[model samples]
Target: MPIPGNLLTTAMAVMPHTDPERAIQTALSLDIPFWPQLPKFDYTEDMYVQASEHFPGIVLDMTAKTLRFSMDKFLAEFEETMAHFDDPAYFDISPAYSAVYHRFLAMDHSKRKAIRGQLEGPVSFGFNIQDQDGRPILFDDTVRPFMFEFMAKRVNVQLERLKALNPNAFMFIDEPGLQFLFSAMSGYSDRAAKDDVGAFLDRIERPRGIHLCGNPDWDFLLQLDMDILSLDVYTNGEVFGSYSGSIRKFLDRGGVLVWGIVPTNMEPFSKESMDTLEARLIAIWDMLAKKGIDREWLLSRSLLSPATCCLVNPDGERTVEEAFAMIRTLSARLREHYALDGD
Candidate 1:
């Protein structure tokens, strides 16, 4: 599939809304609108829970609001689950899993530059969910492979569904857990994480993307064969500057960068304005340009977004709405300042 180019403002995975209709309306307001993951409204919309549907051995307790794996359950349902592994419909995300997915799909998207969908990444899901024995499913040799392949199938199914709505449809693997790979206590090694991610990306048939809201091994991630890299630039922008070589190669290969410039957290969000945020983004770009990466080239192949998902804000959905407004205004101002209006 041809990659979507010159895309502008969009958002991260989750939205802080309880209403699906309102959330879809907010999504359609963006240049590259995405379906909102409304965990506030339903536990099923939780990123990990959304990815857990139909997997063998997984158990969800609505009353306790918890999810876990069961070896006994997995053994019993293993054959049945594998039987439907090849069925695309088996991985389809129905309204039950996403309150807004089907509603978002029902909207008119012909004029959209592109549409985006997101799934909890295998690494994150594996680490977050534990087996009946309290060990992370990621450490389970048998279950880990099954989980990775299961996520790949889930991604492809959603990609195809979005493609039908817009040919430029794409999916992002939400992987905040990736930051753990760099920690001494993570147990999962960096090399193992990279190999797992590379293999997982290979299974995705359409353009693959990863969203890491925390700083990780930039050099390592930039080397992966993903079409887009979305990160929290509000906090990690300067740290990312040290990876100029990787950034240059990534952009040179026609990769897109979703610059998560607008702050989503309450502290930073309160201190920033359009002027300050613009200056911050330009400062990072200037730093890159000094290292020989073309500023104009970077602007042309970039998209703007809120630094991360907005679930932590105390002001609730209003804060998210404000952050997105800033993103739209900032995108337009930058495009005009850089004379990229034609592109």
Candidate 2:
């Protein structure tokens, strides 16, 4: 897939705002405006719960704020759920799941470079939701296939809706749980997870992307057949920069790397300025350039974002707002410095 033109700045999935209007406005202010997943406004906006709306056997406990799966419920409703697998409306995300999705769709996106939407990845969703017997649904043979298909359909419907607003629209899968793939305690092997992710990616017909907030196996992730790879450069720049070979190969294949350099937390956000962050990002680019990757090419095939979603913070939405401001400013400065005004 060809990289979207002029995708210099965007954001992760979740936002900290309780006001839907404010969240939508904040998203629309970016170079690549995205539909904000406002979990603070409603429990249904939680990524796992948001994606679970139509899935069979999944139960959401509003009082306890937890999710669990029931085998008996799955067996009872599996056939009916599979019957409408090809229907796009069956997997549509209603206003119940997102407070601002409909409002976002009604906005004017004509001037935006690109638009983005996101969902919880299968690996993260399966690992987070537990069965009645206290086992992850990912490890369940019967439910895993359906879960993957369900997520694929959901992405398709959302992507279809987004494309109507702007042709350059795309969706990314949030996989913070990817960090556990290689952990001995996870019980899920890295090879198995890779194969699972590949299979899931094959089902989506549009440009595919994945975002991980933690420092996962960089080599393993960069080697995947994805259009974009987003990571937390604010905290993991040193380790991620060490994977110069993988980064070079990924870029050579027309992959766009979303360098999430802005900090989302108050403590880190308070300690850095636009000048310092720009220097930090440039140092990493210089390191890669010394290893044979061109600096100009790196800037061309790159996007900017906060390190991760800002859902939990002491200062609430103010921290996330500041992070967004810094990235937008940094994007303009980088464009000027690299003489990329034509892009």
Candidate 3:
């Protein structure tokens, strides 16, 4: 597919609090279908926490209101099972996998052109699962490979058809945990190493990109094959420059860059304005241009918005409305700069 080479926001999946109509409307109004977040109801409803039937013997759910995993059933089921995390025969998705997919389908098919899906990156997934003692599974050699392969296959089965329907759809694996991954010590397993991380990435396919957000594990991720490199350029904008060589290589490989240009959690609505932010973006664009990375549609590729990053507590409904306002100005500037039309 000839992916549109313009700007886009992180597909902020409809959380528990967001009005479904509003979430779908937000994607439609902004012209982006890939909203990878679904923590709209409670923080614990996260994809990892909402374990599917595919991965049996692992109990990741709790009626708890926060983001902690429930260990009662898990510990009971896997008394010596932390070692089982690496055992391939033990890592089967429950018979209920279809039910989970069915639930996702209900929401994704809610409207036409609903570009709905998720992300699953090697570095992050390698870091999410834990051992029998409830530690980073990546550090446990007996299990890292099993966990990695399971996640890769699981991610594809969950998202493949979603992409088929929307074609322009996207999926993201929330791997914000990669930044903390370091080389293994004598007792720790080295799952985050470039080669180890790349192995899992090799398991997945790409066209609509995966997101690389929060903290920089750039030595590996930015260099991988992908459709976009999502960054919070507005606040953490300085991080991307840390890997100048890798980033340039990523762009040269036809990777689109999605700048998290809007403020979320940090800067509030009172301090935001399109005119002010545009000047900041112009400076960033100029910096990229100096590297011979500038393209006319670069601004479009540079998404200018934020999403309800935290859904459990809920921001204002107008939070999305505020983001749309800035994006509107951005769209106008882009249309004029590129002389684009209703093609």
Candidate 4:
């Protein structure tokens, strides 16, 4: 499992179909093009939309940016929706996803190494959605399983679509909320957390990965069945480096590691030179190597990224494209520097 000399970015970063032709043009420009989450086009593109849509007693005021679920209402719809999980329409993805995907299909992908599709993991989605009383859905016994089914179906659909285009296409479960699982209020035990993630990953096959934008219980993830572990290396590289034993074990078992070594913020992106960023990545490897992982093993298993999604500037959408261009240049320099394998 040699690392693909390609970059990865979430859908939150790219805008599609705002100008149909231009959107596709921008998508093709990336080294590793992925399905974009055009939230600006429609709020439904937010990670939780697929699961929230079939909530039993859901209340949404998109204009006001509010959502409150009704347990009673949810319970009623829960049976039907859960029973119809196999039906394609039951887990229909947003048009924003389809728009980018269709455009991706129409374009030439011969030069692309691997493309990616991402979804909000069940843990994060459950922790974020709340009942009318403001209680988190993760604490609700009835609603929890329903949410898992909802997201599982959604991920299955997305994976099927991406695999149809290319088997090398990667699917990732974004779990930013895992960082708070140990807090008193989250009510998740280590075993329960593993169970939740396992449920979400049950249908996912190889070439799948998990992206945690925040520092999390890395040990738990290391024990999971994912082929890749994507981290917020720009911020948590040291924390991750401390787990050198786990890193060695994971890589030894053929897992890929994506170092989110690039900074996503405009200030850092503008300030850090390519040499500085490359040195930063090398430093991380040096730390891991000291802990007994071979440097070449570390490099062979590594991928590069700009943490997660970078937000668009208040005044200009072009800033995002500029940032991505910087990322493309950085990716090229790193690959050439390491003589990494190409797609």
lDDT of 2 at 8: 82
- Which residue ranges in model 3 land beyond 4 Å of their true spot? 8-10, 14-18, 40-44, 51-53, 65-116, 120-122, 125-132, 183-192, 297-304, 312-315, 338-343
Best by lDDT: 1
Model 3's alpha-carbon lDDT is 0.54
| TM-score of each candidate structure, all chains considered together | 0.96, 0.96, 0.76, 0.88
Q: Write the per-residue lDDT of candidate 3 for residues 67-185, one digit (tens) a residue.
A: 22233544454445555645543433232332233344545443443354554454555466554566655565645565567666655654566665666655555566666666444
Q: lDDT tens string, model 1, 225-329?
A: 989889989899999988999999999988899999998778888999999999998899999999999987887778888998878778788888888888988
Alpha-carbon local distance difference test for all models? 0.86, 0.85, 0.54, 0.68
Error of 2 at 188 (Å): 4.0
Worst 10 residues of 1 by lDDT: 1-10
Give residue 341's error in model 1 in angstroms: 2.9
Residue 110 of model 1 has an lDDT of 67
lDDT of 4 at 33: 67
Q: Which model, 1 or 4, shows the larger lDDT?
A: 1
Candidate 4 stretches greater than 4 Å from native: 1-24, 94-98, 105-111
Over all chains combined, what TM-score does candidate 2 have? 0.96
Q: Order the candidates by TM-score, highest first — what do you get?
A: 1, 2, 4, 3
- Residue 136's lDDT in candidate 3: 54
